[model samples]
Target: MKVKKQKRHRKSLTFYTACFGFRKPYKVLCDGTFVHHLVVNRITPADTALANILSATVKLYTTRCVLVELKRLGKSYSEAL
Candidate 1:
């Protein structure tokens, strides 16, 4: 006797949309380079792009290491950050 195989059904787009009704929050780690680019020259295209990308659904965070490095780079810039 031959056994019959059953086909699996995939979830629909509406099912996924209903499952995720709200945008998920994201945590982003900020390093020395990101901070430097942000504070340097007041603003740049890269900074603007970063801002646009992180404006929604993201929270920025940094560690003591990054702060210490920024401090060592320059007092004014570090303070701005």
Candidate 2:
């Protein structure tokens, strides 16, 4: 039973991830999503339109999203990864 539950959880993770981020060597996209639902006191960037676009197009992510964003902007977060 434990093994079956583990498998089901793993499968759910796979499906959830596929529905969320897109993967690349350098970065991933949030797509504004699940973790966002959990965040409090989050700030948009200085530019509202860019923030809006990101909010619109990006789905769900965690701090992992910030790591990917850093990488996309040619910043580093390998240690975080």
Candidate 3:
């Protein structure tokens, strides 16, 4: 099942790279919720995890708004920031 999922993800990545010129060291945009999930689930070393999922090198990015949101959410979410 995991192999199948990986293959499917690879296929989708291929499509994006081919048609949209997405390249490796793929850039991943993360939101507050995503960061929270990572913290809550103890998904440490987020870049490595995302890279494995995308089957390529990855760079994670978050916007100022996301940072603010996480900050506003307070201490429980502070680790995510």
Candidate 4:
């Protein structure tokens, strides 16, 4: 199952690189929900986790609005902030 998933990811990434010209050290945008999911699931070292999935290094970014929303959610999500 994992091998199949990896192959699928590789094919998709190839398409992106060929058609969309995406480069390595992929940039990933996180929303409040995604951040909360990561925190709740204990997916620490987010860059590494993302890199493993993409089979390349990654740079994580989140919008100011996302941060504000996470903050608004208050203490339970403080670790995400």
lDDT by residue (1-81, candidate 4, tens digit) is 399999999999999999999999799998888888988898878888888989999998888888788888886665653
TM-score winner, 3 or 4? 4
Which residue segments of model 3 deviate by more than 4 Å?
75-78
Tens digits of per-residue lDDT for model 2, 1-81: 367766775575567559976332213333233223323224332134223433323233337666565456442232222
**Against the true structure, whose TM-score is highest?**
4
In model 1, which range of ten residues has the least summed lDDT?
1-10
Better of 2 and 4 by lDDT: 4
lDDT-best of 1 and 4: 4
Poorest lDDT segment (10 consecutive residues) of candidate 2: 31-40
Candidate that would win on lDDT: 4
lDDT for model 3, on a 0 to 1 scale?
A: 0.84
Which tens-of-lDDT digit does each residue in 1-81 have in candidate 3? 399999999899999989999998898899988888988898877898887898789888888888888888886665653
Q: If both were scored by lDDT, which would come out higher, candidate 1 or candidate 3? A: 3
TM value for model 1: 0.49
Model 2 / residue 26 / CA error / Å: 19
- Worst ten in a row by lDDT for model 3: 72-81
The predicted structure with the larger lDDT, 1 or 2, is 1
